[model samples]
Target chain A: MSILAIQNLYVSFLENTVVKNVSMDIEEKKVTAIMGPSGCGKTTVLRSVNRMHELSAHASVTGKVLLRGEDLYALDAILVRRRIGMVFQRPNPFPTMSIYDNVVAGYLLNGLRLGKPELDNLVEESLSSAALWDEVKDSLRRRGAFLSGGQQQRLCIARALAMRPEILLLDEPTSALDPKATASIEELLVQLKKTVTILLVTHNIAQASRVSDFTAFMYLGELVEFGASAKMFTAPQDKRTEEYLTGKFG
Target chain B: MTFTEAAKTLLWRQSLDKVFFGVICFFSFLSVLPLVLILGYLLVKGVSALNWQFFCRVPQPLGEIGGGIANALLGSLILLAVAFLLAVPLGLLVGIYLAENKKNWLADCARLSVEILQSVPSIVIGLVVYTWLVLPLKTFSALAGGAALALMMLPVSVRSTEETLRLIPLELKEAALALGVPYYRTILRVIVPSGLSGIVTGVLLSLARVAGETAPLLFTAFGNPFLSLALFRPIESLPHLIFYYATSPYAEWHRLAWGASFVLVVGVLFLNLTAKFLTRRWRVRF
Candidate 1:
């Protein structure tokens, strides 16, 4: 069954509609990828799901986003966002926070006090799940800013995983990382689907085809085609999707 | 060594440049000299008088020997503590509201008003407080004095806190908000802690500014020679006592005034140094 369903979504800034009448279903325990060029508003769709766009002074969203038949927009954002966590394009692991603290910042962000033992377990579990535990377990107390770029991105993923979010949104999580780190994150995402739903927004069609169970092709704020990743890449039904996949145009 | 060699004149040109740079360094040193001399003089003149008696004994009669600045010290404490209690939270809240929440006309008005208040002379502040508080209250008590000093400290704390809060990156706020933390809790837990060192520094600086002020106390505390335990009673603070005793014809009162000035300088310096030490220790954290 679909865990996340968007119906007739409309997103606008003043009079300009950026996303119009887009509808798609994200299945549970599967990685779904949205592929589009820059300015296609794929990131906007991701951000709107978690309500980060609410912070924008001019942006407004009108749509019903259902998570297991419950409207996400109508729920309190704090509760909604807890169930649906996001990792940004940039690795933002609170520069002053220690690597250990950065991993479990979601708990701290929610004001949940964990006893030392429980906190230690949470830190280990989240980092191991994000495929970063072995790399950073030794110097966990060191400042996060000292980490190399790839480690920082993995640290951000660990932070999101610490929340135990039911659904995770990655807005080009590997865009800022080197190829080695990107491959590591993509490998981790494949393993993560056993416990969580994942939605990835990216421009790399190859990455999407390799990691995603389902793929959605977006163009000019519209969902042009969406299906099983293998079928969509090999036997696309839409001419636009085929042309875009073949690099006829972005 | 002809016309071309004359223009090159290496020794002369080099000596002239060295002299010019040396003179500039000397001028910079000269600019900082007066403050250094005064601070050193205050340290030597003041610290020597900071004996246990200065904090223990009451001021003796005007002509008596071995009297202390205990009454003035206690009065300054009462005034400053109460003033800080009144000013710090209110000023910080307004500053946060201005910097984070509002950018409309009211915030603009508040900014302009604070600017005007900061530029107003301390003597003028004393005059205004005298008319506003002393007249209505019928007595220059600690409350009146504290309220006057609270006014003095508020603008300083607010301006500094606002600037510090502004210096914090917007990305931190966004990160917290994206985590599903409510905005208010995010501010209280994250934003406030992030800017805490700067806020504490601002409060300390404002406290330092308010402690040295004499004019506000002149109209509000009005200088009581005998120590009074009650906040409602008139008080003797160091600055006011200094003004009174320094102007008196008695030789003992003059010595006491210089000693009290010494005490005040040391106390304020210690507070400043303490804040600096604390902020440095906790500058980087989770």
Candidate 2:
């Protein structure tokens, strides 16, 4: 079943239309990767799903974003964000918060009161799901800023997962990590798809091919081609997708 | 190009560097000389007057012996407490507004007004408050004095809060919002806590600055010789007491003024140290 559907989604910031009339369906519990060069509006499309783009001044979005056949744009942006969580390109774990607090930040911010044992369980479960529990469980009281870059990124993912959102949008989550750290995040994403649908926007084509179930190629504010990962990698139907794949002026 | 000539030039340059270092050290010591001399004079003159009786009893009549600045001390404390209650919260809120809305017309106006208020002499503030509150109430009271001090404190606290919150990255706010936290809660929970050190330092510094101000209290609190707690009646403060006694012809009053000056200096110094300690202990580096 399709969890999210975009219908001719158009997003513009002041005078520039970054994402021009794009439509696609995201399958349930599957990883869909949007790959493009810089300035291709891949990140813009991902932000439009949860209306993250609206945070910027003078940004206006039109058309429909349907989550489970309901218009997402018609709903409250704050509530929509709660149901469809997002992780940014940079790992921004709250510097003032401890590791344990960072994991349960969403609940605390929502003023959701829980028993101590329940909170402990939630924190542990979220950390374990993000594959960071063992590495950080011993030092939960330590500040989030003390963590290494990769661990901080994983902590961010754990924070988002604590909300148990139906869909997760990641905008180049591994772009700042080392090669080894990047590999672990990619492996974690493959495992994560068993329960949550993911829409990933990436400039790294190799990362897209390695972990995605499906791939969509975007260029100059338009989605040029989309297909199964294997088919898209082996035989792209569009000439621009072929050119991008072969590194022709990307 | 001879080796001796090169050595001579090198020696000259090294001597010049030493001379510059010595000059800098001399200026540093010169800046501290006045403070050291004043503290020495105050201690020598003020210590003989210090005693348990000095702290517990109100000032006696001019011819009588053995009186303290107890009334002035209590008055200063009450005036400061009232001012703190009136100023800190409002200043912090205004600061948060200015920081959050960097480009808005309201924020710009608020910033300009705060700057203007800061530059306005404390005496002018005292006169204004005297006319505004004292005249209306028909009394020179601690409340009037406090209102003037609160005005003096507002600019510092507001500027500090705005600058501290501004230093915080926008990403932290975005991260909280992404988790579905309301904007106000995000500010209260994340931004405020993150900038706590700077905000606290701002508050303490402003409090210390206003505590020493005498002109503002001259017109507002006026002066009282006996201990009184009523906010509606005239009150005596440390600075006001010092001002009245220092300029008086009596030798006893001059001695009492020096003692009050020492006490006030110690109090202000302690507050400044606390502010410094808080910045070190609770500083959250982003």
Using lDDT as the measure, which candidate wins? 2
User: What is the C-alpha lDDT profile of model 2 across B94-168, one tens digit per residue?
Assistant: 999999998989999999999999999999999999999999999999999999999999999999999999999
> Which parts of model 1 have CA positions greater than 4 angstroms off?
A95-101, A113-117, A139-143, A178-180, A203-210, A228-250, B1-20, B47-50
Task: Report the Cα lDDT for residue B106, model 1.
Answer: 89
User: How many residue pairs clash (N, CA or C atoms closer than 3 angstroms) in each of the candidate models, in the order given?
Assistant: 1, 0
lDDT of each: 0.86, 0.93
What's the CA error at residue B121 for candidate 2, in Å? 1.3
Q: TM-score for all predictions?
A: 0.89, 0.96
DockQ of 1: 0.45
True contacts kept of each: 0.45, 0.75
Q: What is the TM-score of chain A alone in each candidate?
A: 0.98, 0.98
What is the lDDT, from 0 to 100, of the residue B286 in candidate 2? 58
